[model samples]
Target: MPSPYTVIEIFMTQYRCKRERNARKKFSNVF
Candidate 1:
Protein backbone atom coordinates (compact mmCIF):
# COMPACT_ATOMS: atom_id res chain seq x y z
CA MET A 1 0.00 0.00 0.00
CA PRO A 2 1.11 3.55 -0.61
CA SER A 3 1.64 6.18 2.05
CA PRO A 4 -0.80 9.05 2.38
CA TYR A 5 1.64 11.63 1.10
CA THR A 6 2.54 9.48 -1.88
CA VAL A 7 -1.10 9.04 -2.78
CA ILE A 8 -1.67 12.76 -2.50
CA GLU A 9 1.33 13.47 -4.69
CA ILE A 10 0.10 11.04 -7.33
CA PHE A 11 -3.33 12.65 -7.35
CA MET A 12 -1.77 16.08 -7.62
CA THR A 13 0.37 15.02 -10.55
CA GLN A 14 -2.67 13.64 -12.36
CA TYR A 15 -4.59 16.83 -11.71
CA ARG A 16 -1.72 18.90 -13.00
CA CYS A 17 -1.53 16.80 -16.13
CA LYS A 18 -5.22 17.34 -16.81
CA ARG A 19 -4.86 21.05 -16.23
CA GLU A 20 -1.90 21.22 -18.55
CA ARG A 21 -3.82 19.43 -21.29
CA ASN A 22 -6.69 21.86 -20.97
CA ALA A 23 -4.35 24.81 -21.04
CA ARG A 24 -2.75 23.53 -24.20
CA LYS A 25 -6.10 23.14 -25.86
CA LYS A 26 -7.04 26.69 -24.90
CA PHE A 27 -3.72 28.05 -26.11
CA SER A 28 -4.08 26.31 -29.45
CA ASN A 29 -7.47 27.87 -29.94
CA VAL A 30 -6.01 31.37 -29.33
CA PHE A 31 -3.51 31.03 -32.13
Candidate 2:
Protein backbone atom coordinates (compact mmCIF):
# COMPACT_ATOMS: atom_id res chain seq x y z
CA MET A 1 0.00 0.00 0.00
CA PRO A 2 1.09 3.58 -0.57
CA SER A 3 2.19 5.77 2.31
CA PRO A 4 0.04 8.66 3.57
CA TYR A 5 2.53 11.21 2.31
CA THR A 6 2.38 9.76 -1.19
CA VAL A 7 -1.40 9.84 -1.18
CA ILE A 8 -1.40 13.46 -0.08
CA GLU A 9 1.04 14.37 -2.83
CA ILE A 10 -1.14 12.76 -5.45
CA PHE A 11 -4.17 14.67 -4.21
CA MET A 12 -2.26 17.93 -4.20
CA THR A 13 -1.15 17.39 -7.77
CA GLN A 14 -4.69 16.68 -8.89
CA TYR A 15 -5.95 19.76 -7.08
CA ARG A 16 -3.31 21.86 -8.75
CA CYS A 17 -4.25 20.56 -12.18
CA LYS A 18 -7.90 21.29 -11.52
CA ARG A 19 -7.05 24.81 -10.36
CA GLU A 20 -5.00 25.40 -13.50
CA ARG A 21 -7.80 24.20 -15.72
CA ASN A 22 -10.24 26.55 -13.99
CA ALA A 23 -7.81 29.43 -14.40
CA ARG A 24 -7.47 28.69 -18.10
CA LYS A 25 -11.24 28.62 -18.51
CA LYS A 26 -11.55 31.97 -16.74
CA PHE A 27 -8.91 33.53 -18.97
CA SER A 28 -10.57 32.18 -22.10
CA ASN A 29 -13.87 33.71 -21.01
CA VAL A 30 -12.20 37.11 -20.52
CA PHE A 31 -10.34 37.08 -23.85
Candidate 3:
Protein backbone atom coordinates (compact mmCIF):
# COMPACT_ATOMS: atom_id res chain seq x y z
CA MET A 1 0.00 0.00 0.00
CA PRO A 2 1.25 3.45 -0.93
CA SER A 3 0.21 6.80 0.46
CA PRO A 4 0.53 10.23 -1.19
CA TYR A 5 1.63 11.92 2.02
CA THR A 6 4.52 9.48 2.36
CA VAL A 7 5.90 10.47 -1.02
CA ILE A 8 5.62 14.17 -0.20
CA GLU A 9 7.31 13.60 3.16
CA ILE A 10 10.22 11.79 1.54
CA PHE A 11 10.65 14.45 -1.13
CA MET A 12 10.54 17.26 1.40
CA THR A 13 13.07 15.52 3.61
CA GLN A 14 15.46 15.08 0.69
CA TYR A 15 15.05 18.71 -0.35
CA ARG A 16 15.68 19.94 3.16
CA CYS A 17 18.78 17.75 3.51
CA LYS A 18 20.21 18.97 0.24
CA ARG A 19 19.60 22.60 1.20
CA GLU A 20 21.18 22.08 4.62
CA ARG A 21 24.28 20.48 3.11
CA ASN A 22 24.70 23.32 0.65
CA ALA A 23 24.28 25.91 3.39
CA ARG A 24 26.87 24.16 5.52
CA LYS A 25 29.36 24.21 2.67
CA LYS A 26 28.69 27.87 1.99
CA PHE A 27 29.17 28.88 5.63
CA SER A 28 32.26 26.71 5.97
CA ASN A 29 33.84 28.43 2.98
CA VAL A 30 33.03 31.85 4.42
CA PHE A 31 34.55 30.93 7.78
Residue pairs with backbone overlap in model 3: none
* Model 1 worst lDDT run, 10 consecutive residues: 2-11
Writing each residue's lDDT as its tens digit, candidate 2 over 1-31 gives 9999999999999999999999999999999
Q: Residues 2-31, candidate 1, lDDT per residue (tens digit)?
A: 999999999999999999999999999999
Q: Model 2: runs farther than 4 Å from truth? A: none
Error of 3 at 11 (Å): 0.3
TM-score per candidate, in order?
Answer: 0.88, 0.94, 0.87
| Residue pairs clashing, model 2 | none
- Which 10-residue window in model 2 sums to the lowest lDDT? 22-31
Against the true structure, candidate 1 has what lDDT? Answer: 1.00
Error of 1 at 14 (Å): 0.5
The per-residue C-alpha lDDT of model 1 at residue 15 equals 100
lDDT of each: 1.00, 1.00, 0.96
Worst 10 residues of 3 by lDDT: 1-10
- Candidate 1 regions with alpha-carbon error over 4 angstroms: none
Candidate 3 yields a Cα-based lDDT of: 0.96
Give the lDDT of residue 13 in candidate 1. Answer: 100
